[model samples]
Target: MSYGILSKLKLAWTELDNDQKEQLGPYLTFTDYREIWAMGIFLLGATALLPLLIVTIIHYQLIQTSVNSEFILRTERLTSNTRRVVTFFLDERLDALRFTVNEIPYNDLTASDRLSEILSNLKLGFGGLTDLSVIDHKGTQLAYAGPFKLKGKDYSRQPWFIANQKKDSYVSPIFKGYRNVPHIIIAVKSVRSDGTWFILRATLEIKKLMQTLSSYKTGRYADLFLIDRSGVLQTPSEFYGDIYQKLPLETPKYSSRTQAVMTTDAQERHIIMGYAFISAKTTDTPFVLIVVKQKDGMMGVWRRMQANIKWFVGFCILTVIIVITIACTNIVNRLYHADKAKAETMALMEQSCQLAAIGQLSAGVAHEINNPLALISQTAGYIKDLFVIKEQYRNDEELIENIDSIMEAVDRCGRITSQLLGFSRKFDIKTQNVNLKETIFDVLVFHQKEAQYRNLNLSVDVPEDIPDIETDQGKLQQILMNLVNNAFQAIDDGCSLDIHATREGSDFVNIVISDNGCGMPEENLDKIFEPFFTTKARGEGTGLGLPITYGLVKKLNGSISVKSKENEGTTFIVTLPVRIQKEKDGNENSIGG
Candidate 1:
């Protein structure tokens, strides 16, 4: 059952008009219209985006390179200025300590009263001095003043003490010592003539050192701080960390001159940093001064430019896709129409040629054969008449039957010749009120004998409610006869044929003829109405019956369609208008040979 349905659908698809067929042609194969459309879009997209991608990459690299160069220059400058300020501060304090040690006697330095006076004088001159202390060669604090009491405190185990002993002077990183405030110590070691050593140490305020570094005036997002060789923060940074905290940045290789680098921070912010090692002339301990700035902030103008370029490129790609789609669709549609028109023109020309050749052949046959058929019919009638008059011959039943059979054959041939003549002859439009049921009956009657001989079941159902339609009687009869004859020829023994007729609308009637037979395949069904196209073997059919029927129906202003499957059956439907309107000239009959 499913196979039957599929065959029907296949037949219907093939029966579609030329325009519809052309529209659906591309879909009937592996390479469909949608695939073609997709391929076109892909090509256009690639073409449009290739240049955009290249330009975007080049622009991005250029922006990054230019920004990096600018960031390095700016950060390096800030680093240099901050280093200078920090170096100056440390030098001043060390120089002050050296002077104090050289000018004061060793015994006086050890005296608490004299050390207090010296501390007062140092604080008055340098506001950052937090405290002052005097230590002997044994790393013991003999005298101390300001914020901490140390009449006799041992400092031998301290890193600063060991460093100060080895070096003439040393500057330590800021730390919370006994005073519990962040401060750095600057210690100067002095030797007497007898090689007796003493040290003068002063704690400088961390806030004052930071203020000097910040005064350099960097960018808005820039930060400056000092880190030890181990990457530990010595000074407080607004964005990095507190003093004595570890810095996130890696420690740079020791360098006296400033060096800059670009990197991303933990927050994924792009940054440029410059660092310089601040080396004191009198000490070995070195501090790194770092200046950091945000890369995006430094290249804000370039970022805006990149964004604009991206938007422009996106717009171009979209525009190209739309334009290419429209253009491709237009081109394909135009080609489809042109090809359809060409096919229709070719079909019409071929039909014209077929009709011309058939007409000439029909005329010749009718002229040459009609006379002999008439003569044979007349002679056979005369033979029957003579046999009836002669008693002896009339009594011979076998001879009488033979003469009657000859007369019948002669009449059949005459009818066939007349039909051929009528088919070839063209006539002006003629209309008469037609009894569709009676006409169908007449055509069916000719095929009834053959149907019975083959043991075929034939049925006809014309509704009583159907009204008579006005059409060309001869053409209508021919149409019905051809269709009925074809139906009878299609079936074998025990098959069924059905004829149905009804009024379709106020202006038209429909007749359907169906048969259970060895039906045609889909390919043959498509060409069933074309001139001289047939499934019958050579010599069995002229292949002109259906074409002539088709022409006659067209002359009466009607349409015909057929559906068939390979093994199921065949059905032909004829739709005719109730009436064909006469032309303005109103000639009842005209002749064309």
Candidate 2:
């Protein structure tokens, strides 16, 4: 968001190769870059999270299916086991009736007192027996015993009696018969040698049958009840309804083996229902053993596990986002600093090219001015010669003096042009042996007049022991000229300027230029050697003088430093090697772009 943060973002962009720029040109703004970052996150997130989501979905389905199957299987198993128990109980009661009809005589069964005694003994031995009855082939209730009293009751129209006539043995579903209480009956047919037949019937308590089914444990929110084929609940149900209530669930098709299925109940609770059909041997009405269990109870662990998986996936996404943001920030920061450095380097190269162009133009202008100055000096010298040779001009001292002054002015102009030529001629280093003291005087030539006019005291202190350095003559001269010029301009009338040169050990020389003038602030010292950095008033300085001077020193295997304090004085120190080492020189090809 801040300029300082994305400052070099554009700079780095500019450095891209041409081919890369053509392809990446769409990314031209900060917003575009940010969009790219967001898109990158999206792509990476999809690559990571898509798989996770797919796996979670697959895993969820598998777990649901497995739990569903397991619950259903359990329901069916419970129903089947309970059905066996109920069937076995019915078989025992039927066997007892069959045994009584075969062993007891028709006369004994027809007597109420005799049948009552048999019923009491049967209850004591087998249990759940409520009463006994005798019926001749004519379907008349000839006798009865125990509990309810009935004598000579005819039952030819009853469904159980009619069904019993066809089967040797029969068992009926639980129902309220003549006594109007829930009970079941078993009938056995007896055939005598005279081709006569009789039926021995026994009544069993329905409570004992219910107890047998209810005793088995089902699961939570589960119930075991009997339902007839007509969808009527024959026994009490916990959630469906009481006995004889029309159940909401459809009656299952009769199957000897157990069947399990998942369904929703009246309350919209999911339930797993398992059922087994019990076929009545005598009556057409059949009953089903039904087991109901809530599905929620069976899959509690799966629900908890699903919740945990969601949390884990959510956490993983958050971590990925955090990691992406941090990595992008770090990469962008590094790119910013690197591109900032490159941008600074490019500016320096541009400055060098500009300096070289100015140097070329100066050389052209100086050469053009030299021809006129040479002609003027030649004409002035000829006039002075004529004045001396001819008698009429020889006495005219004023004319002679004017001619001499004209030649002097021409010479001064020539010297100015020569300084320009010397500065412009250098595109590369040219080394020469030179006298240090004389070289300083040559630089001072253009400034000596100003020094005198300003009444400034100038001191040159060069030790004789200091040897002439082997280096580029033009570069060394320019270095001296710029420093001396700056020193002169910084001072006022009567200020003392000092140039002190000394030998630095055996290999180097030191040129110290000191001026007691208005020096710059301490902070400006570091930037003084940077191109276009200056403390001077706007138009007076291009700010390249000292920077150029510093660069020249570096090219000549030398170093430069400056010390300055505001309102005090400034000193420039230039250290040069006594001999230039060209074979080891590396600055020649490093000047500019």
Query: Each candidate: RMSD to true structure?
Result: 10.7, 8.6
Give candidate 2's error at residue 492 in angstroms.
8.4
CA error at residue 239 for candidate 1, angstroms:
3.7
Per-residue lDDT of 172-213 in model 2, one digit per residue for the tens? 767789878877778888887889788899888878877887
Q: Which stretches of candidate 2 lie over 4 Å from their true place?
A: 1-40, 136-139, 161-171, 188-199, 280-285, 300-426, 429-593
Among these predictions, the greatest TM-score belongs to: 2
Q: How much is 564 displaced in model 2, in angstroms?
A: 14
Question: Would you estimate the TM-scores of all the predictions?
Answer: 0.60, 0.64
Candidate 1, 272-390: lDDT as tens digits:
88889997767755588888888877777887887898898788888887667666555544544555466566665556456656666777888799998889889889989998998
lDDT over C-alpha atoms for residue 126 of model 2:
81
Each model's total of backbone clashes = 0, 0
